[model samples]
Target: MTVPRAWWARLPDPVIDAVVVAVAVVDVLLSLVDASPVEQAMAALACAALVVRRRFPLPVFLLTLPAIMQAIVVAPFAALYTLAARSRDRRLLVACVIMFALASEASWLLNDLTSDDRTWTLVNFFYALAAVAVPVLLGQLVQARRDLARRLVEIEEAREHERLLHSQAVLTRERAQLAREMHDVVSHQVSLIAIQAGALQVAATDPDFKEGACTIRSLSVDTLDELRHMVTLLRASGGRASELTPQPTLADLHRLVTTSGIDAELTGELPPGTSTTAQRAVYRTVQEALTNVRKHAPGATATVRLWHADDGAAFGVTVTNTPPTRPSLPLPGAQQGLIGLRERAELLGGTFESGATAEGGYEAILRIPAGTD
Candidate 1:
């Protein structure tokens, strides 16, 4: 079983109370030589008030003032020191100063009978001030240090929050880039498979059926080989030099549209090496726009326009398509894709905007600054 302990044992409150009571009794006994019972009783009570100085410092000081005046020689200066250290209000400090000054002057007046009494009285006043100032100065120093430590902790927490936000942003961008790469690889291969399958189905009875089947098999094998090689390269290079492979630049817009089963043409000359960031942004914008077409605008042809100038210092890509007549499949939410595209472009110091055209077609426009390339 555990044992309980008294509060005083942990905090020394009872011991402090006992010390105050003892000092009051001693002061009362000493005052009996020249003071009456009422004066002695008042002095003893005032001295005992020091035990609650931390909680009621101003009240205790006010209560002790009468006793101090009655018997200044036995005024319990120790209680005054306790009051000064415990209280932080400037009013309390000012009160203490006034009291000290009065006590010094009073003592000087009483000891003016001797020839060198002025010197002795000044020395005694200085000693009393020292007793009160030492404890007050220490308390102020401790409070100042604690305030400084708290400010430092707040600053460190703010910095840590900023670092976490930065890390999350970087991780999000990398995941988007990975999604674009996977879309390019998988979409191109799947389109080829669908085309070969259609051709083989129509020529089943023809003499060249076997040759077409062989071609389909070879295409599938080639796709698998390329996927394996890309995965191996990604693992070996550890994602850093993985970008060494030519990313789908403006030149690849035609292939992207064809793979999406859309008869689209690229107009205007496109910029070259428009920064990895810009290239990735343009690729993702086109990839997402085409995927939307495949899912929601099946059998609808699209047009893509790429414009570049200033020696590849600026570039823009826009894709637009009319809605399909047949019932379209539900496309992914436009808000999410647009948000991701906006983030990608803003990160590369660019802009992206997409909306439905007045003619019932959807249009996506992306522009990037190539100066950062």
Candidate 2:
């Protein structure tokens, strides 16, 4: 079992009270030697009361008051000290003063029970009052110091939290700046490519070269459309994580197939009220798969299939394409499309599968949980 944490475990309160408990025990012993058995009993009771004085300060102090006639009293001082340090009301201070006088007089009377000296008793009485005052004064100082320490801790914590928030704000602004720079630079370059393609289409007389230029122009327009969408996201969110725009969903797969200029078929059905995230993931998967078909299989036909679990807990997309017609369009760089798609699926607690079929065709499959609202 875990131990309960004590507030005073790291504090002087425990150490100070430990020594005081020891002193009270010693006083119990001394009273047995110097005074009557009745006095010794009272002293022992006072010593025992000291054990809980810290736990039950005011009550223990008040209980110790009647026993003060024989009180060698260590408990009362400890109790008064606790009260002084913890209590805020002025009424308790007045009570402490009155109780302190009573305790002091008791201590003095008990100290010289057999003495016949009146003037000396008064002097001893004053001495006892001074002794009681010491802990009260010390307790007040300790309380003030503790309050100051607590305030310092709160201030430091607030400052640390503020610093972290400021650092995050700076990082967000930097990311948005990087996105803006990329939008400006890449958009300019793509626009130039589109212009050159348009010029080539106009200047060229051969049908073959003109067809190539038109394809180039089409691809350029599509790229610019995707780029503008991204740039608008960066501007809107101003953060690393982009807020979703109107991403193409399963419903838009027909448009995607037409744009790919491929012989294609789509089948199966999307569940009613499918989630936005699942819809986006399905669209991207199909889009990327169709792009792959265009690049690697050129004139070959592709089929896209989408389905939902009977219980409406999961939705899926599968894109498969026939083998290449011949040597096709060259694709550069590492192909991160399917890898990125797999990550997106897994992040949503879903799955992705892709491989070449026995028929010499390639198939890419993605499944994502259609979580309820």
After superposition, candidate 2 runs with Cα above 4 Å error: 1-19, 66-73, 106-127, 183-185, 206-219, 236-373
User: For candidate 2, lDDT tens digit of each residue in 282-344?
Assistant: 888988898778656756789989888888778888899998754333435477988999898
* TM-score versus the correct structure, for each prediction: 0.41, 0.51
How does candidate 2 fare on TM-score?
0.51
Query: After best superposition, candidate 1 residue 73: deviation in angstroms?
Result: 11
lDDT of 2 at 247: 55
Each model's lDDT: 0.66, 0.75
Tens digits of per-residue lDDT, candidate 1, 137-181, equal 665565555444544454455458669878866765565466457
Model 2 residue 180 distance off true place after TM-score fit, in angstroms: 3.8
Listing every candidate in turn, what is its Cα RMSD in Å to the true structure after a full C-alpha superposition?
22.0, 23.8
Tell me the lDDT of candidate 2.
Answer: 0.75
